[model samples]
Target: MDGTTLYAVDGGIARITLNRPGARNALNDQMIGELLDALDRAKHDDGVRVIVLTGAGDRAFCAGADLDGLGRDGMGVNDVRDSAPFRLFTAFPALGKPIIARLAGHAVAGGLGLAAACDLVIAADDVKLATPEVNVGLWPMMIMAIINRNVAPKHAFKLYYTGSRITAAEGREIGLVTEVVPRADLDARVDELAGVIASKSPLGLRRGRDAFFAIEGRPLEDQVAYLLSELVELAGTEDAKEGITAFLENRPPDFRGR
Candidate 1:
């Protein structure tokens, strides 16, 4: 664990928390680096079947990037694309495991991007989300790619143009959030969802997730052909064979991630 982030694993779920509640869990360079490291650690850990990302307090999942920290080193506009936050944003799709964002509070700017990048977002009903970079004389540049993928173009444009905050229910309706529950029920809901994902075959989950990302933007025929090939390959894995056998025997499958 680093100062900016906390990492823990239990019951096949890796929990990575942004530990800067004092700063509303804003992303600084150090936090971004630590977050990427934690994600890498979880990705390589065979025992970790699912991941949950949240902040240290109920006030915010993350407020946004640390604006005060930006340009501290005379950073140029062109260099923004190569910054730590950019790398962290790109890292999510390559993890090959389900990531659930537990948004107990507001997720703004890059924070909203972080939640949108996750495979699923379980947000507290009281929470708000926004891409309010425009309010600060900037734009949600780095997060736009991820956000656009999750939210419809018109809705995304509205967010970028208005810099308005939307409720968790609105976020769900716009596809930014997977589910929303009362604040009291957030933890229980996240755990239940994570536990169910972790119980699946790890190998299957990994391959299936990889395919989910890979087939994006491909021609319809190409996507179908690629998925067919993937299915054939997956069917030959030991875990797949075991899964089929277990189904026939009316028992739970013991997947070894083979």
Candidate 2:
């Protein structure tokens, strides 16, 4: 919103870009606030069915927080719970719409958390992802929750302990990245994937996303019972009825987010 980030919606896709290319698109307080604002805007916009998040530069998708600005305002332990990064990461689960991270370059520290928070991550083959906070005498405390959910404990521990960078391919292998494409094909691939996701029923997508997050950490029996109720409710929606009818008629369904 303040030139620190860019927000644009076209053809049901909201593109939120980190604009501090000169600083490797690092997150400062202003950038983080602007990003949260963009996400909120997209979340409330009915026309936006999908979100694409990326940085403005080729050098790094995001190099993480701007360390120089961390304590500029005398931030302390008392402020950790209300920090912008904490709110941003927590916002993802409640956003309802799908988010696809476009990683054309490196994603490190909190940047990797940003990608992991998304529903999908499409990275360039040359991209590198890491949690190098240990190298700087700090830990990725805020992003640890997000990264852990996306990656297995063992692989995540190795990254945290060694402060090592992994290739995009390795990231996919370890479940942090969804797909890896060549740099030249990254934009096209991401766009294609985003388009496909955007064409789905908005109500279905929102309810399904909500259901998945709701079922996490629940007992197996409870999860199945909850999902069964959700499925029955979803099947009764207008979009679902239309989708079923259209299938029988060999035509595309017109979903109105119902």
lDDT of 1 by residue, 1-258 (tens): 969999999999999999999999998878888999999999999999999999999999999888775444225546766767667888999998999999998999989999999999999999999998888798987789999999899999999999999999999999999999999999999999999999899999999999999999999999999999999999999999999999999999999999
Model 1 misplaced regions, further than 4 Å: 71-81
Model 2, span 93-196: residue lDDT tens: 99999999999889999899988999999999999999999997988877899999988999999999989999999999999999999999998999999999
Count of clashes, each model: 0, 0
RMSD values for the candidates in order, in angstroms, are: 1.6, 1.5
Task: Give the C-alpha miss distance for residue 21 in model 1, angstroms.
Answer: 0.3
Clashing pairs in 1: none
lDDT of 2 at 135: 94
